[model samples]
Target: MPQARLLPAYLVQRYHGWKATTYQDNKSWYRRLAASGQHPRAMVISCCDSRVHVTSIFGADEGEFFIHRNVANLVPPYTPDGQTHGTSAAVEYAVTSLGVAHIVVLGHSNCGGVKGCLDMCSGEAPELLETSSFVGRWMDILRPGYERVKDVDAAFRARALEKQSVLVSIDNLMTFPFVAKAVEEESLTLHGLWTDVGEGGLEQFDPVRGEFLPV
Candidate 1:
């Protein structure tokens, strides 16, 4: 909870240079954002992978989308155990508090967590399931998914796992009472998307086709 005191002042210089062109034109926006409240259109749950950026891909400006990032964007079934999760809290607030109309789960190609779960590739068992180390447990949630495509060609298998992980996250996203209620009441729509990191291809979930289709 400490202030971002570690932020290098020089890094502000990078933004400073751009501020003249963009920051100057949007000075009112900065003022209003500071004074006004957040009114985002959607909530995006994405991976912690550095290569996969939600804001950049969607060209979302600050406050346009409420976002939550985790090692694999895993949404646990609503647990009343008093352990509040940032992702779950974001969903609760965005839906119940802010009334966002859509919730998007974004996953990408060549995810290390998916790969670990797909192949159970971790070297140590304790390390796999540890509270802080999530790949093992999160991967377990997708074990059925892994088995669902394990026998396919290696290239196809990888693609399937990455794609299936989005579905897994979507299903889990629904387990939260707020999310389910919102969806049931038609207040919110859920979307699962796969981004091909290499070429930035956008694929949307096609339930009828039982796969992702180019969009």
Candidate 2:
């Protein structure tokens, strides 16, 4: 048998230590969780930024949230083209299979993906202009947001786009028939969140006011 190319030695050691301590303190909890399947109450679609920790922000425990991470936390409109859609797949599973009550699209400040979109739209990053650029294509989901905020000052456009991305995703989530049906029946609720990493501030979207309020 061939050995797998594992993570760095220090990270592996840290994982071992964490595994031992977690199991030692929560052995029964882990055992019970293994016996019973996970029943998370919410599904969180969050940015794939290292600084953003969804679980830490909400003080969520294991099996509490079904999390899906993607660039800029953007959700493209639901298209049933039979092509691969990782984010859509996760959303479908969370709604249909897990029956989660809440779905949150979490966007954060200083998202590299958002910045990339900004750069691409502004013609600063020509490399992203290529049709073969995955980041460019994926970030295209946020292009509509950029158009809305294009007139804003360059310094603030990025931040504006970050919040816009959340709004865009929330709209896209509704494009899915199952999601719309669930929402219409009051079986599922959608939420949008924007976080400031440096200032440790959290803002929640208010559908009534059409704005994000501090949390």
Candidate 3:
């Protein structure tokens, strides 16, 4: 078997520096965490976009948040087929094994995945229509969301779909039986949040108001 290639030198140097500083600053915390185990109270489902920093936004510490990131931060409807379901597997681990009390679907402004879905639904991005387009199939999870926001003016469709993605993921989360049971027993709670990347503003979804409001 062949060994994996090494990372770039710059990244390796940066990682070493960070490791040194982290050990100097919080050696005991790291040691304790290693001896004990993770007991995160929340699971954050977020986008794969590099701009969205989940821990920085929430000021979370190590072992505090169990995060699962995918394109558009989507949670597909529960399917028990014997296929690889990465997001579903993460949700199962968070809910059943970790017993996370809260699940937060974090969406964001100017999401490329949402834009891709918008483009695909609008018949603008023809390449994504191919059966081999993994991203296209993943973005299909947000197709229903695109339908709900498609009628909006082109200028605002991307933002609208972004928020809709959060709502859609929340709805899908409930489709999982364990998640539904946890909610019914008051053992688990769900939240929807969207962030404006440029303005650095946060908005939370209100089921009662059926809108995202500033947080």
Which sequence of candidate numbers ranks them by lDDT, best first?
3, 2, 1
Per residue, candidate 1 scores C-alpha lDDT tens digits across 134-157 of: 567666777666767877887678
Clashing pairs in 1: none
Model 2: per-residue lDDT, tens digit, 9-118? 99999989988998789989988988999999999999999999999999998899999999999899999999999999999999999999999999999999999999
Reference-based lDDT, each prediction: 0.81, 0.95, 0.95
- Candidates by TM-score, descending order: 3, 2, 1
Clashing pairs in 3: none
Residue 77, candidate 2: Cα error in Å is 0.6
Q: Write the per-residue lDDT of candidate 3 for residues 134-209, one digit (tens) a residue.
A: 9999989988898898899888889999999999999999999999999999999999999998999999999899
Off-target runs (Cα >4 Å) in candidate 2 are 1-4
Quote the lDDT for 64 in model 2. Answer: 97
